[model samples]
Target: MTELTERIERLAIQDGTIITAYHALSFVRSSDVSEPVPAVYKPSLCVIAQGAKQVLLGPESYFYDPGSYLVASVHLPITGQVIDASPEKPYLSLQLQFEMDQILDIIQQPYFTENTGHKSHRALVIGQMSNSLHEAILRLIRLLDTPEDLPALAPYAVREILYRMLQTEQGNTIRNFALLGSRAQRIVPVIEQINREYTEPMRVDNLAKAAGMSTSSFFSCFKEVTAMTPLQYQKRLRLTEARRLLLATMSDATSVAYQVGYESATQFNREYARLFGQPPIRDVRRFLGMNPQ
Candidate 1:
């Protein structure tokens, strides 16, 4: 626990990006009850040290407290809030990103093998953090203490961390994605296409063609991987972005609706209230502490 704290603090100094450590990495300052914010988790692992967080992956929800980590093998649109955090003992967390190329290399290693049967058919998963994986993470963070070593050693440490992850019991849960032609592997292209064209109206036939699957096959596979229909996934993405624009830019409700692809402002406001428990203006105002009319 103390090691986790020391590692994050040390690594933070060397990290120039808003991200304190690496491309697929982020740190929490530790907080209590964070103001709800809108965003999505890409292909990354989320680890918590003190409190808990709830991640909505489509209709299903997942929660990970201390001693646990959530790995998103693919970039899935999600809604996350640090439902638990406080200044006294803010929920501390570290997020590590995973990429297909790197995971492929790891999967190719002869010494490291995998069994697909146990691997999650779903893209996102929660695994208990083991001492080996946690300690490896601590070591990577410790590298921040020696600045010169970071350039030469950080990459190696990152790989080793990936190796440790591959060795875990549920390691197979995440390793399957990197292996080419797996069903989960096939879902990648479709997910990418939706991510890029999320703002546009989707054509099921075109998307299914792009995914190289019959419409029926595509629908089944997409729903299996994401637990939602394609359009449902798009709706979540749109609403998440609408919330972001309103919160960040103080954009008006009608404008936010249009920007997010809603055809009618009235429909947008109705859906926003249903999804977020309030109309766009009210939700944004409460989140940003702005005066309400």
Candidate 2:
């Protein structure tokens, strides 16, 4: 634990998600309690080395600290807040983004054996961090200091971490993520399509056909994996991107609405207020500290 803390502290010199030489590994440090921040959580492994945090996915709230880590296997729109932190202790964490192809590579390995079948759930899972995994993470972080060693050794360290993850209880989720023709695997393409085309009109039949599943089956499977219906999932994606554009560009409400696939400004205002607790303009102002109320 001391080694992990020291290494993370050394690596996380700044107060946000700091990208490393290894694109898959990043570090996070926050010094204060955070307001509810909505984000699209990509598939990744997040480990907390200090403090704690809570992530709200749809209606579900997940909490994790140093003892546990969070694994998000799919893209999810979520509200994340640092529930436990202060100036002195702060919140320190790291995230490793894994690609589906990497998982497939592991699956194809001759020695790898599938273990523990898991039912579809919210695409997110919390699992305890074992000492072995922790040591692997430490080694990966240590490689940051040796630039020449990184290109040769980092991949093996990352692979070792993934292999260790396979030995954990949530391994099945990881397996299903890469297994060809599996229900979970089938939904991956649909997620990618929706993310790429969230601004366009979407039909369940079209999406289901794209996934090679019947309408009813697609609806059920999508809900099982994402914890939301197809429409709801698309809406979340749209709304999340809308919020981003609003904050980043400060574009007008109506334009941002259409930009994110909403045809009616009135409808956009209504839904934006519902999801963000305020209209677009006011939300932006509040976020920017121009209008505190």
Candidate 3:
């Protein structure tokens, strides 16, 4: 095994995810390949030290392993699956969450220069991992060994990691998302609005106005970044939330259908089945069988 994987496996002795001493950083390990699980990915950097994984956003699929890193520049609902893992090696990885302010801070430095006027790119991107970036990540992980040093040095290591990312080919995409008034940045507020009121009825024209763009321009930019139309994105949000609610509460399929804003039970069942590959009640029962309370 490589040093990076070994370090992660050692730190994350148990399976599942753990929030490390550094609050923004977390480690994850799984012993076997997993099923597609839906989740909302925050703005963060995901590096896999051992095995490969796949992330599905809309119809697009992204796969990454030790040689690459994945970045989610905005909130996106996605399906993630571990395509590779074994009992002996397991799947070792770490995710470091950061805010737009952090990216803006790095861009303000004189050494960094990029044209921020570029049009929006996909919010999810994969970049080739360089030796410098790998070393920076290793240094950050090594801090767990010296908990006391984390306070003084963790921030610097994290800063270096972000700086290295800014130097990559996809750096322009990342920069534009953080730059004020950039098309990508302008779409962020609208994304936030959808996330907050996903259950509410959506008005495309109103959302476009909120982003200060015409309907066509807004629609194009939004799809360019998210890989889905506004209505499709809202449907994803609704279905994902419905799955969570069904598992969390005793609510039946019909109740959850309306709870997530579906006007007709028939439409909810059809869409939910389309997204999850099964009817709501059957899927919930299968999930319960696999994981019993």
Candidate 4:
């Protein structure tokens, strides 16, 4: 492990809910990062120091380990699996949530800058990690070890981290989310619509209309906002919820499938197996074992 990572892990504790520190800090650890957990990744900067993880945004996938860092510029319902980890080398991560206020403040300043006009990228990205960025993350994590110092110094440290991200390949990713009229702005309403009506049978043409473009333009922008197409976005949501219901209650594959709007149990099972690496019953069984209450 790097010196900075070692120091950060020394200070974090697993409280179950996302750990909120003096300046929005948390250190993530697991004995063996084996499977993906269901979670909504809000706009944030998540850096990994050790081990590796894969995030599925719809049908598309992303992996970030020591070699890369992740940035989620919009709130996205995602499936993330830790692709690499072991008892001796567990997964370790540091995540810092972003605020539009911070980005807006930065842009209003004299030195703030970017060349993001008419440019667009996926809302989430896994780019090659840089040594400078790594060191900055380490510094942010280390502040947690010194609780006394955290009270007076954590805010400045957090700002430094944000400032560094604003100046990297992540700059446009951050700016579009904050500034109005960026492609990110055009897609926010459409994304919210999908999240709200995930349980219903959705029509791509309708969503394309809501997003205010021709079917082709909407499809292009939607794919850019989410890593996958609209149908893929809804599919993940269905499977994820079906898996949740099967675990939370005594529901068979058919019932669980219906609960999430599947027309056929056979189809649901096939898709579930494809996504979670097992059929409904077996996958739920494995899921329960891993997360038994």
| Quality of model 2 by C-alpha lDDT | 0.86
RMSD of each: 2.8, 1.5, 2.6, 4.0
Taken over the whole model, the C-alpha lDDT of each candidate is 0.77, 0.86, 0.91, 0.74
Candidate 3 lDDT at 261 equals 92
Query: Per-residue CA lDDT of candidate 3, range 172-207, in tens?
Result: 888889989999999998999999999999999999
Per-residue lDDT over 68-127 for candidate 4, one digit per residue giving the tens place of the 0 to 100 score: 788887777798877776666666777788777777778778887674433456788765
Report the alpha-carbon TM-score of model 2 versus the true structure: 0.95
The sequence of per-residue lDDT tens digits that candidate 1 reaches over residues 172-241 is 8678777787777778878888888887889887888877789999889888888888988888888988
Q: Which sections of candidate 3 miss by over 4 Å?
A: 115-120, 290-293
Give the per-residue lDDT digits (tens) of candidate 2, residues 180-204.
9999889988998898888999999
Least well predicted 10-residue stretch by lDDT in candidate 4: 9-18
Clashes per candidate, residues 3 or more apart or on different chains: 8, 0, 0, 0
What TM-score would candidate 1 get against the native? 0.91
By TM-score, who's the top model here? 2
Candidate 1 Cα misplacement greater than 4 A, ranges: 9-18, 115-117
Instruction: Please give me the total number of clashing residue pairs in predicted model 2.
Output: 0
